[model samples]
Target: MADFKELSRLLEEILEQGPAGCGCAVARNGEILFEEYHGVKDLESGEPITADSVYRQYSTTKVAVCTGAMMLLERGKFLLNDPIYEYFPEWKDTMVAQPEEDGSYRVRPAKRPILIRDCFSMAMGIGYGGTDYTHQAAEKVRAQLRANVGEYTLQQEIKAMAEVPVAFDPGTHWLYGFGHELVAGLIEVVSGKGVGQFLKEELFEPLDMKNTGYHYFGDIRERMVTTYLLKEDGSREASPYFQRDELFEPEAKYEGGGAGLFSTVRDYLALTQMLACGGEYQGRKIMGRKTIDLMRCNQLNEQQLKEFRNPYLEGYGYGCGVRTLMDPSAGVNSSVGEFGWTGMLGSYVSIDPAEKLSLVYMHNLFPNREAYIHPRIRNIVYGVL
Candidate 1:
């Protein structure tokens, strides 16, 4: 057993410096070595965070979404190297942007078509943020989302994204963009079901992740934790109440995968545990051992590594929707091949297959202070082991 005193100290440190309420759990080989929560779920009522507290998973939702898609790959639904346009049709022979001397980009024919692997690896060239062509393409989809809330669908939004020129030739560069949309879209097409429905039937239900999904249900609203805005003066303010759809509602207004999914610490730990434990939970196998292996393998190349330069991800390599530790020297005392990804609200998942160890940390803070918070949490979890 590991002494989790340092981990507790981190919970205290975050309350003082970041989120109002937070929770963390560390599991190894199906056994929880450490699990703890601190502070209040709502500062106004002083209601404490418990095992039932649900959170907006933000980008941490990527791990599960990718895992769900990988199950299809294991079943031979589609090959990663296959072109996405084969299924979507519109994405076939997509145009690429060329940069000119006037600081503007022009459209050009792509050397190679966007492959399914490129979407999984975020190399599909759809930019999630920017003022350029990529932004316009993605933003048009978002504007439609804002314009027709509760009625617009991800299928519609992703098709809107598919209509524009790509940021680069597929597989030529690495940019954290809207590739997961295509991944989920592929799942919808191949499975002949919505992404949320397929995941619920295939991933969530099998893993017993009762509180995890794209939309909330039952008492989840009452149990949901509040997200906060941490100010520079070390004060935290409550963010506005976010509107949520009812149980079994279609998530036509929300972004699927990374930007969607409401979950709890316990629910998400089940996912990380399954991945770290060779895709098994209890007696059931949600994914194959080698399939899990392929998902975490580094997919980026030499030039792509230079482009995947996230600040907290200095020593990592881009895998299928997750970051795999590539340089231990540059990492935060983590193991080589340690793979996971964080959410927009400071939630994190770090999986080490070598030890069959994994960590799930959750907090509700915008600007997700990953540089200061995540590395410390990861090192503290490792320090006692």
Candidate 2:
């Protein structure tokens, strides 16, 4: 058991350091030993956050989607090296990046096909659609995505995305955002079910994650916390609440696999616990030990590793859904061999397999102004261990 008072104090400090509205939980070996919530769920309504408060998980959704894919892989549904175009034929003979006359690169035919492993590596053409050659192509698709102007099917969104050119050759580098969405689409194709239905059948229902899903509904909607974005002046801006009535509409239907899904701390901890125990929880095997081993192993070469590293992640290698390389002296103070991912909305979950510990910190706030809390919380948890 953990020192409850110490953990509580740390949680209190974290809440004090940031905005009052936040939820956090820590679990070990499938048991939630410490959990806490502070401030309001909805600032306007003054609704307090609870253990059941569900927040938009953003990129943390990648872990769940990746787990879904890995479960199918363990079942021999597909192989990692298989060409993705084999599953989504529309992606075959896609375009690559080439320099235009003005020194800006434009999309042309790809020399090779995008593969299944490329989806896992986030090498697929999807990205943040920012001002880069890759995102330039992504931006064109984004405009089309926004222009649909009505209820759009997932297939339509994917097809529109398919028309966009890839940023780089598959397997050349890691670019986050699109691979998980492609994986979600692949799940639909292979399972003969919608991504939501397939996840409910294979994961949510099986794991008894009653409160978790792609969209908020019923009583779950009431528990959903409003997301926030911190401004440069340190003020908080509230995000629009996701409404079931408005779902399937163009803006909402995008349902990005990489950064969509809302979950509670309790619910997400169950997931990490399952991973920590080598793919078993409460005698249920979501994946085999060997499959879990493969997911956690470093998949990137040294050169690939260099390309994947960034300000948020330094000295890390892409595993299935988590980041796995560890350099203790890299100055992050996180454990070596720890694997986990963070959400854009101030949510983080990491499993330290070496220490048999997992930490989950979630907040609905965006533009995580006080970014120090994540590392500090990790340090506290590691110190206690």
lDDT per model, in order?
0.84, 0.74
**Global fold similarity of model 2 (TM-score):** 0.90
Please give, for residues 1-385, the per-residue lDDT of candidate 1 as tens digits. 3468877987888788888888999999999988998998899999999888988887887898899899999999999999998889878768887778998889888899999999989998986788887677667767876687645666776666676788888998998878998888888999999888899999899989999877657887788888888778988788764323332254344547556888889888899999988988998878899998899899999999998967788989988899999898886687888899998888899998888889998987876788888898888888777
Candidate 2 lDDT score relative to the true structure: 0.74
Summarize candidate 2's per-residue lDDT along 168-264 as a digit string, tens digits. 7777767777777788888888888877778788888777788777765668766777776666776666756522324423235546568667788
Cα TM-score of candidate 1 = 0.94
Ten-residue stretch with the least lDDT total in model 2: 242-251
**Which residue pairs clash in candidate 2?**
228-366
